[model samples]
Target: MSTDLLQARDLTIRGEGVTIAPFSCSLGPGDRLTLLGETGSGKSLIAQAIMGTLPKGLCAQGRLVIDGEAFDAADSTSRRALWGRRLALLPQEPWHALDPTMRAVSQVAESHRHVAGRDRRAAFQAAWSDLTELGLAEAGSKLPGELSGGMAQRVAFAAASAGGAPIVIADEPTKGLDAPRRDAVVELLARTPEAAGALLTITHDIDVARRLGGEVVILRQGQVVERGPAQQVLTDPQSEYGQRLLAAEPSRWPLPKPLGERQAPVISASGLAKTRGGRELFRDLSLTIVPGEIVGVVGPSGCGKSTLGDMLLGVTRADNGEIDRAQGHTLGFQKLYQDPPAAFSPHWRLSRLLDDLVRRHRLDRAAIPPLMARLGLDENLLGRRPGEISGGELQRFAILRVLLLEPCFLFADEPTSRLDPITQRQTLELLVELARERHCGVMLVSHDPALIERICDKRISLEATPSVAKRELDPVMA
Candidate 1:
């Protein structure tokens, strides 16, 4: 008798000009497997194939077996019956996966009661325990919108695993989390295989694969370039692509150039404070940003990092603060969102959106081609909608959209959290170079402390309590 928890033979995905080559793998009891790749490399496609949730126009062709039940990957609905009972998937973006109107605990409890076949009271208690274990005991009553990116991710994980599924698939589980929270998530993922279940994770973070301590298969352009044990492959990779990817980690990046002489201020904020869900995010925060400078912000998840950016851009009202923008530059203030897909319309093609922006602003259409080339964006990508492209591509397009307006102040809220390491390094380099060339003031927010230390000319560290400290990046580190 075969005791494999999950198996896929010749699993292949095909769409228009793109094809994920035939791949095969299996997971047995107490086994862990991670698919390591960059955005658009077909990592998510393979997970979606097993889950039977491939996007429209893409089709999977392979044989999939989960918990001794076999199905055809081509049939998208074949695996729906196993969802949350024998199979559970934690999606890449928790905000989109979770229901906006439902409270966190209720969502998990519903899964437990319905899928796990537990009674109402028992399910509620189990859900509570899960949240408590994940350090989200107080967040149970909060809605998805009220939680931060990392908190919402934990709630989604709790809901997904409440059914006690033996086969677990997590996609980009630690994409936008701080070091401690990311480690916590890795531990939770490890618990699945530790309890005799099987774990299949799809992530672009090398550290995630290292922590998971699983078998790794590296992909590039939808083809496998390397496969081996985590320890051997991660520490000493045999493939060239894998080496490049590992070298792109922010900690390994070269130090950015030292800050030049100060210039006129672009934006200034004084005594900023915000309270959400009875938690004080920060208080008495004041800072000034000069043109051609990059300011980095670091803090724990849910510490109002995004809120602070919104207040500076005038998107949200501050509880106690006054913001000043350089006169005559009001139209130049813009923002780059954390989630690129959420900021765009799913129904419209990229060309349509770009045309709308250009028309609305009366900007030059001729400049689009040169900018697209510089961003390394292909011309064919313009024909696809926001959902049709990868997160990395959509983010570069977002940068293109903002740069066209010749902005003097840009607030980027965790802009590269979802990007793969190589693409992330490239994107930040371009952003910094452009900012310096145009003399734009950039308020850069990231969860990685090493990233901030390497690139920012100034730094702002926010705390959970009522305090915010702003200072210059130490020249010694450079």
Candidate 2:
């Protein structure tokens, strides 16, 4: 007799050395619930449990009701029939959700055709329309591998929601999006509830939850710390963790100290040009990075921010420009990926991978423990595989690995996008400190302009056209 579209009664999750205590919540028609928390705080796990997609070795318990049908949470397969018909999930990592071999439009069309019960032609048309609305008109024909991280995210969203499920779950839905695109995504999510459907969103961005303006549940270390209306909880959070999370926004962060003196340039490039998908991304770009300096990159999604970094690191060739690295430092250039799990072997434990790197490069084993402590990583996390740990932890681990080689230049591609505000602040502060200490030049990429403004000494702003500009802060500001 309950009118709720979905309900969880004392749902709990268990895994090796981890336990998400009993929690209960529900969503009715036109309802929205957001799980707000730090990385590794069980936000994604809760979403996985609801979607019946928890990774191996993790088990869920308690009762779940979906579309008036009751099922035991432990039997994940019991809800298979409801997938795409009554429930849909947009995973945090779009790469995992999208097929690498399939074109963006085709994947979305598949969902519309099969799950939404539309005809083939109608599905294809709908798919194209979806891509166009998401500002990906040209990306429809590109395979998942060809798209940028933000482009791939939009594709995945189109595919997941094409089914028209009454209940939707989105995890970190706006993680790597710029302000305009991020607002668009939020509008899309808001529309679901407006159309009399139910929505559940998981995110670490406080602004995202505030914009959604629904019920908010704060979790920490696998436990519910607080729950209330979004306006009340976000504006006047009672829990101590909630206040810290809100305070850690980039806008509230303290400005970093200016560099002491200009050092020799670590890398220099001139007249860089690149084109992708038959569109001119950027041309005639030039920049210089000095040791102990942080240069930030900001542009719309798919505007070639990552591509420019690759050009400088020699991972990708520029069509018409030349890159010059400091002499004798060719081996010292490194990169930290946007998705940390993609960079490591999922089957190997973190310790084994670190050991291999140390052995291969003749790095000092003693430096590992201190760096781990400084990064706020627990030693026990090293025992688990990359897929077993949270994204933020893996990213920190990636930084630790890169620092071990004593790199002179680093390309950090949205390194903190997956982290919570508190963790993001902490990680970036540590990265800046280490960059200054080791005199390493870091090119930081981020979707948030405020973040780049706070931490970067210089910034490169890319536009849709071939024009680009590199802004250098004054000595006092830098």
Candidate 3:
């Protein structure tokens, strides 16, 4: 008889400032289940609960059985023993699971040697093979710090499967990867356990859920609002919360109507070509954005979309291209970077940085509170540093800062990727509305086809380069 690998009965998880109400589920052999929800919706928390790795100040109640053994959240000794041998997790944040000082190869190799009891030399060889499978063989020697965000994520995933554990759990496995990498990761996980298909994924990306093809449990504010086959749940969620979430899917959202009679081009590029690491991302690409125009640059990961943003802002020089900037612009270009936490100084208080933007740009301080509230931010967070807040909160703050600048051109690179679904829609809409009010030209870079369709006036696609195969784009149009 097939036995359940992991089971959580009437699980309730809560932390200092968060709560996850009663939710229940089970994962057995050949079971492919995805726990789906937005950021802070307790998706990660549930995974941590099963692994007995809940964060400090957080507690879990009710029954959890792992591999036919009762699990204890605070039993450090057994937890270490169980990891990689019986249970392995790919944490959402790569840095959280990776050791900064250790070389990437050694760390992943440790999993093979320690958990699986492989010979020392054999473990090292197997580690390389694992990295190769993930398309990260060249990065094996590099430390986690040396890798990019997406590379680190891939490495962490490689480590998760190091011991050939029967049950694998990955949290937001596709978070930083581009479309090609995302699809590759999904394929690798789908073939997990030698095709037995015992994999559990926790993520907010609905498209990812559909691709994985399994049972889905839709979570909201820590509650199980709906559950069913992945296709049905994603395609036609019955509950109100489920309906709202699906409605907010970027593909389903309605695109804003055109801004009739666009003004003269605020920025124009001609013959733009950039090469990075001996690979051409896009060659001879040209685009122009008029005042109030929202031009979305769409492409798979590593397709030079962000590089194009740099070229437009005159930050990174294109190998062969010229960009014309409007003359005497009141405010120049400003960027909402892909990663908000990295953009701010760790040493600076949030309030101090915000204050500087307000004073420098002569922004109306009175409008700050309301804006922060709308973004679901707590004003008390202003006293803390960027490291003190979550990525979602920091992203909202980053957007608020750019709005204060009131720049003539806004380079928003996946600004809402970290936000929850509702907030994603609200934030993007607010950005476009503010841009229209200021007649700003926006260059939005993203891998989300739904988002590009909903907000962009002109869609510019960065064709696939040799480094990344598979053009996972919506219909190709100039």
Candidate 4:
């Protein structure tokens, strides 16, 4: 019996007139592998090539064989025939994977109808149950626009698992999710070897590679620089590039320094009660933020963390509550969104946006480079649009945009979740340092308990998740 289920022999891919050196790898039945690299390193490109969806002008050259049949990656007809049976792609960007107009449940059901050949009614039935199990039962009726980054991520996962395709390639599957949610993703992928056949994950998150124990391949500039057992490669890398990559992974954050004398509250709220879509998120919630103090807000998904941030910013009104502000408080509201790319205009060049933000805020232009450098961003990123950059890079840029504003209160929602470990540490450090130096009040809304404990002066947790029956029953009528 042949052990090789899928094999790529000397595959070379070229995009935008640049060539990636010939690379090769194989996956037997029940195999798992990961491709790790930074932005623009051709990790996604390789997946696209394998899925026969490479962008126009990109060339994939070499021999690919699956189940003893030669695979021509450039042939769309052949790919279409194979997809959802022998092959499938779990796209890195959920925003790109899902349809904006359709309800999330319908999209997943669509996956079932197309891949599993289920009848429409059966597909919808299965989809409802599947999404519910993935923690998206309440999100079934939501259009992609209405779902949060994390919510949409779960929707994508449900869709990917619907068909049980034999070969699965998931790209940055856990980028927008919290620890528990992402761990669930890892567990699901870990089981694919038996339920499906092979799993290939593409991510910069070293934790994912570590958790999904299997072969590890490090990609740099489109070349496979290192390949070995996951434990060995991640722990003691042989390649220089691999060593640098391993060194960048973040460890537990250091406890924050001692704080000074207490200050009066900058913003205070009491007896806050909020209900949305006829479902109560939280009730009798109270919190305060004082200058130079960091307040951590945490809870599980659908626990009103982001909603609380909105309420604090005065964008969402509480059904019953009074929020008091200190007299002459000019430093009001600024937000570092979880999905940074979604916040910016895709058509606007980074240069235009950054320049306008800096000049509008009277920020020193010279300080921009050093700030970006601290976050490991390239100055040249300014020339491109938000869609052209990587998620991690876009996140750092988003932080820079807000920091330049120098708001009095910063509602940072999952600010560091999208970042790699090393960059996560640096970004959080810089944000807190500047917040303290400027006497700014910060509310860190996150699901990361460790991070909250490490830096927060006082933590207030909201803990109530309305069931799907209440929220997903009827759309909020106009």
Tell me the deviation in Å of residue 468 in model 3. Answer: 12
lDDT tens digits, residues 1-478, model 3?
4388877788887656667898787777778899876656778777777787775567888776777787654453455667887788987767767898998889889988988889899999999998888778778989987676677888888887888777788887887677788999998888763456368898767778899887999887778889999989888889998888878888777867777887888888888878886677777677778888888877766567787888888888999978998888666788898767667887888999988877887889987898787677778678767755456677899998887776888999888877667778888888888889889999888778768888888777776664443323232232
Query: Judged by lDDT against the true structure, how good is candidate 3?
Result: 0.78
Residue-level lDDT of model 4, residues 139-212, one tens digit each, is: 99999888777888889888877887878888888876777888988888877786648888888788889999
Ranked by lDDT, the better of candidates 1 and 3 is 1
Clashing pairs in 4: none
Give the whole-model CA lDDT for all candidates, comma-separated.
Answer: 0.87, 0.89, 0.78, 0.77
lDDT of 1 at 128: 97
Question: What tens-digit string does per-residue lDDT give for candidate 2 at 368-471?
Answer: 99999999888988888987777778889998999999999999999999899999999999999999999999999998878988898888877656545343
Please provide TM-scores, in order, for all candidate models, with all chains considered together. Answer: 0.94, 0.96, 0.84, 0.84
Name the lDDT of candidate 4: 0.77
In model 4, the Cα lDDT at residue 219 comes to 76
CA RMSD of all predictions: 2.1, 1.8, 4.0, 6.0
Model 2's alpha-carbon lDDT is 0.89
The regions of model 1 sitting more than 4 angstroms off are 467-478
- Which one wins on TM-score? 2
